[model samples]
Target: MSDERRSLHTENVELQRRLEGLTPLLAEKETKLIKLEQEIEILNNKLKQQIKEIENLKINLEEKLKENLKQKSEGERIEQRFKLNIETLNNELEEREFFEKVFLKIISILKSPELTETKIKSEQREASYRREEHERYQRVIDELNEQLQQTNERFERLERERNELEIKIDELRQKNDILEMELELAHDKMSQQQETSRTLEEKQRELHLQEKEHRSAQVRAQRELEALQSLSQSLANENKGLREERADLEERIGELTEMLNIRENRVKRAAELINEFLERYRLTSGRLKQQIGRQAEDCEEFDRLIQKLRQMPIPKPGLVQNLRICGRPGVPRLEK
Candidate 1:
């Protein structure tokens, strides 16, 4: 009985030792799980921040698009105004050309002696008729002068309005330039955010893989722990089984360690892949920046052309002369 008590006491000591060893392994696994959870939480926070930044970028892009649309509409309105002004100027030119032609026709009629002589009789009769015709011509000249004055006033008014419109156009151009700069800044920020998001995605994928590995390790560890518990229960009932089961548990632990090493190697390989991807991304970004620079240059050239068009001088009205006619001795003479 004493020998049996000593054997039982020894078995209890062995079980206690085994339990103590398992306690540390369980504690280490718990620490790893807690650390993984913390890492996952941190990644989640980072992802949330990235999502928020992306949303903000989207909002800014939408606003920029709206501003661009507004500017386009304003430009169209300005173009329409310019067209209308041009049409008004053309109509005024046509009216002036018509008046010039009419004046020339009147001068031709006065210069024709055959037409005047046919209408006139003797010199005394011609003189009285010529004086009456001169009064009528003077009245027509006064009327034409009044019309010319009104036309000049209208032209001056149009010129003033055109100057005002040009000032507005200049202001609009300044605003457009400001908007363009803002858009460039926004685009740069968006590019930066995209790069950050890509980095985050790679990190998230890595974390996911790590988490999956950890869960697998945890499941393997749990199974091993269950086996250890069963073996411990069997060893409590049968002393001969303890050594063999312990050896098996030690071998399983070694295998788990090897798997851990393999997992770590896989993580290193994933990191290398991430580095390669980043290198490719950097090359692509450089090319994109170069293309953006070329596009900016083209846009600047287009703006310059638009500015040149805006600065183009408007055609002014030409001066018109009063009609004068000189006739033969038998005919009447008219002067302006």
Candidate 2:
């Protein structure tokens, strides 16, 4: 009985020692949990900021897209107007060519002396009519010259407008290139953010698991503490049979301690890994932020470039000479 009481007392002392050791470990775990929670809160705040940034980026992209669509529509309208002007000019050129051919034919007929030699009264009458026709031709030639001058002026105006449109088109193309580059950068940033979010989610999940495990361990420790308290309360009455039971309980406690040590090591390793991941994430996020800032600057520069392009002067078309239709006096103009 004395030996059994001594063993029981020793078991109680060892249990107390283990309980004291576990208390500090639990406290340390609680400290770590709180620290982790604080860190998670910080990460959450960062995530929220990142989300806001993404939203702003989306808004900017939408505005840029709308601007691009508006520009494209305007460009199309300009192109259609240019096409109509070119067709009108082509038709005018064709009309001028036809009039030139007619003029050449009239001159050729006038140069044919055989018509004068025919000596028929009809021929003489025809000759008189031909002289009248020549005077009418002179009037027609003067009208053609006036028309030509007007057409030349119109052509010059159209050419100047076309040149201006071409310059605008080239500038639009450059803007498109800049927009495409900006879009690519935005896409890259979005991808990076997504990747970072995924990493954060994974880390959050790991933290949740660790919290669960810690809670379970805390519950188990509480249960063990309660059992030890009950055993202590019943020690006087049950001391005879408790020798073997105390040895088994001590063995179990040792096993629990070993398990806890293993768990602590695992927790340490997990914490190290988490810290490493956080460091990497921090570096990556910093780089992404810098990139985003640079992209914003680039966008601003692109806008400035667009404004400069808009302010640039367009080239004007010079006047072109009219097609000469009259020949030297008494000579026929040859049609090529």
Q: Name the top TM-score candidate.
A: 1
lDDT of 1 by residue, 152-183 (tens): 56555555554554555565456556555555
Model 1 lDDT, full chain set: 0.47
Number of colliding residue pairs in model 2: 0
Deviation in Å, model 1, residue 274 alpha carbon: 35
Q: What are the per-model C-alpha RMSD values against the true structure?
A: 49.6, 46.0
Q: Write the per-residue lDDT of candidate 2 for residues 27-144, one digit (tens) a residue.
A: 5555555555555565555555555555555555566556555655655665565556556655655665666567557655775567545435554575566557556655655665
Model 2: weakest 10-residue lDDT segment is: 315-324
Off by over 4 Å in 2: 1-135, 232-336
TM-score of each: 0.33, 0.32
What lDDT score is found at residue 219 in candidate 2?
44
